[model samples]
Target: MNNKRRVTVILAMAAIAPLTFTACAGGGAAPASGGDVKSLTVLDSYNNDPDKGILQASIDKCAAKVGVTIERTTVPGKDRMQTVLQRSSSKTLPDVLMLDNPEVKDVAATGALSPLSDYKVDMSAFAGNSLDAVTQDGQVYGLPLPADTLGLFYNADVLAAAGITPPKTWDELKAAAAKLTTGDQYGLAFSAAATYEGAWQFLPFMWTNGGDETKLDSPEVKGALQLYVDLVQSGSASKSVINWNQADVKDQFVAGKAAMMINGPWQIPALAKVPGVKWNTVQIPVNKPGQTPTAPLGGMVWTVPRTGDKAKQAKAAEFVACTGTEDSQMALGKARNTVPTQNGLHQKYVSEVPTMAAFTKQVEDARSRTGKLGKDWPKAATTIYTAVQLALTGGASVDEAFSKAAAG
Candidate 1:
């Protein structure tokens, strides 16, 4: 999440970028013998509580079902990839690893991960976009336990007071935002920092406007950039957005400094705790009346690293498989306030958690950040966020932001 670690991951990943899946003969090494081989070393970024407990509970349940003990190492998200790379080079990678969806393909391309299919991990139940994030060259490498995307979160009371409904189109959004701007509270809040979080937040606008990641300097992208710039320049949004992350944006909304924000379902649990802060969500507004919003799919997927020992790998795969079962996915998604990645469970999940209906619909047509460019997506993500920072901070005009940022 920090710039240093992000750049480190980008550089470290290139060291093992070979695209191969040839399993080592005789499975390299074995764990312990017989009954001794009942535990597995796992790595993940569930360092924060409630989420950490939820993930561990599911993992504990799965480990029991699979007849194994889990020895999990919780790391901060910014350090997980660094730890993975260090352990990888030492041939001591964890038996099971949790990776951000985009990083799944990057690590897989390095041939440092085992194919889930090799261990009979059923891949049929996952959503198409969620599955695509972990697949490369026809090999399925990981299973996404939950999938998420951004939507418009609005304060119901504020909207009612302003006599404004949630916007349905870009023009409506701009008008509503302008009308909502009042004393000490801006109409909207969103991240536009020079980080991947910023790029993640911008996807709906960029994609819904017919922008392409492959063409970063296109008119559509500039138009999307202009939307954010206009909001900030008009004082409908704060200039501090150039430094805010999604968390900060949420905080602004909770404090009533912003009436609307673009965020994902994962924040629901926290939002619920703020007494009487009634809120509701809608799909991200489209650029035009006929256009559909397409947001970037987001989640951390479970993977089995190439730990050499076939037996451990198999057990790890079973553990990974267990985490993705419909029951586990639903339980974890509910506890963590996220959407299940299994397509068949969408209706059931929404029925049980009606607040997530908007997100479920968005996830149905969501796009993977790495789907088009695979491992090369990081570079494009950097370009996107840099352009966003520049445009939002007045460092460059919307028409020049992409070209200038791309040149850098």
Candidate 2:
């Protein structure tokens, strides 16, 4: 369930009247001397995402345990919430806000987020790249709730009928794809249109080949892109995938229109539930023999905004601290098919969504986005997709497209 929000700064109840902002750090980062314990405002884009809902629920759960209630305000998407928060620099930019993995550094660059590392929370305990994505300039900036990795999805029945095993090495994958191309089914599927899905879908290829969007001209880049071109030119890939968007590809993959796809941990639950269908996940085919598995990291974090409401900031900080635990976080993995940033999420997730365990295994070796973090990361991804789309149109060579893209 992506339905989550980062609940922040409650402003009601406590031993006080109405509530006035109080500021200051307590010993070992406790709530300030004077604070409001009654109401808090959380800014989040999860209202539509639903996947981020765990954050809001956790805050509410923890608040009850500690005796506090939260008033959450959800934004439609990243742009809307970031716009509001940016404009409200002088005003309190909602007590807490949602921060995606790639945007952690950018948001911190604005000097808006309060450092959780300086507070009561111990940063290292978080799972995966939580600390890397949120830490900026050697300071912790935000707290990521869900952490995920990218990989390939397959229709188990389809693979079984074809008498094929999941490919373990990159070379084997190509041969398998060649073998699996029995009919309308393609050995693999990926989006090529200039968009998020198209761009994100290409990352695994990039990573496996030792290339990334940032270094699109590397030889590995050429080899990786060649695979996509082969998938299309050989009529083993779907053209609609290029521009139809992410949801389209997922629906198609789930409906059995395609045999395999590259995706993130977020889709694990829904994919597992495909009725009368057998589906399984596996890491992207490896590039080098005996090398560790690889994938692109995905997910978001929670951050607090400072507006002179020291009490509100302190409350938001504590609420964030509540959800950053390994137990609570991995427990979430069971519920959402998401991976926690902490290490202990293994047993928790294995018990709930076993199919996802392979996906989570990549966390220790997965790579985050190479481009600098920013609220605009999605925009950059879009730009890269544009290059993919243009190349897929058969208008230019993959090298030309990426070369042009790199310069662009």
Candidate 3:
């Protein structure tokens, strides 16, 4: 079974009582009853930001076009996870939900969202193994909407000031870091702290080394760890990167304190706003020759909550699938710089956001982080990352890092 199709089948969340279910139902399924049920709810993690405004508009447009009356709510993504857990425990799950991949796995373990495997739709139009990212226990739990990847976002002026070209390989990146470091200025800003941001940047390196994060004992993973250690211990990077309770790496990059960073497409608009800043983006480079450039995929997805009303759930699923189709995707393309997950929409978004095209293409060729890793990924990723950080920071040996982390 190609890793893309290795869906998780475990329904471990049965321990938490399934939440009360109801699909968008004041109206009938399919053709509908001319108008949508006036009182439907969607819970998402867009608590007041660009994602909030754009996503709410998208929801309103889709729901209105379908004649469905829908209400929306926003919560922090982390808090949304707790909401899913709480709702699963209290039986108050929302009718619709928005989540990213890791949260999808955590929520799936609780059996709260409806699986769309039975929903009729072709999967060939999507990118990366994004569809696979949301598959759990051999079932489709969510629909990946916009696909994205992490990349090196550099202030063109910063690199230009230092007279260095963009680093083409990890080794070049380190060398450039040394040359670029100056008073209050760093050549690189990465998410090395113990948080989601840390893993976001670190995972791509592990993938470039040809190691699934699920296999922490692999040599590739170890080599990736050593690279990170070399960066920090050798003064190529700052040790304060590990300081807790923040995601300010991008902030540093944007303010010109750092010359480059590993961030997703979401950072583009904000970075563009910084004056006198000429920035360009590129795919995260591999360690050396013969290895492909790697980028850990990231993106948002839509899903219907598992409900007692099977027919309504079915209706909602179809609508969700419709939102993923080529037409809706193209419509989305017309309005934003977002690349559509649909087959050809990539070309379209590339033209629209030309400067960011290379980064998007990297994601297209990038392999999905799946299989065993897809199932229990969050825990495994944290375990391996923490272990690697320990060794890189001089707390453990390379072998000891693997041995201690793999002891699980």
- By TM-score, the best candidate is 1
Candidate 1: how large is its RMSD? 11.0
lDDT of 2 by residue, 221-267 (tens): 77777777776776677666676665666777887777777767676
Candidate 2 Cα outliers beyond 4 Å, as residue runs: 1-34, 48-56, 78-90, 212-214, 370-383
Prediction 2 global C-alpha lDDT: 0.69
Off by over 4 Å in 1: 1-36
Alpha-carbon RMSD of each model:
11.0, 11.4, 12.9
Decoy 3 TM-score against native: 0.85
Ranking by TM-score: 1, 3, 2
Using lDDT as the measure, the top candidate is 1
- Model 2, position 16, has a per-residue lDDT of 46
Worst 10 residues of 2 by lDDT: 1-10
Model 3 weakest lDDT span, ten residues long: 15-24
Ordered from best to worst lDDT, the candidate numbers read 1, 3, 2
lDDT (Cα) of model 1: 0.89
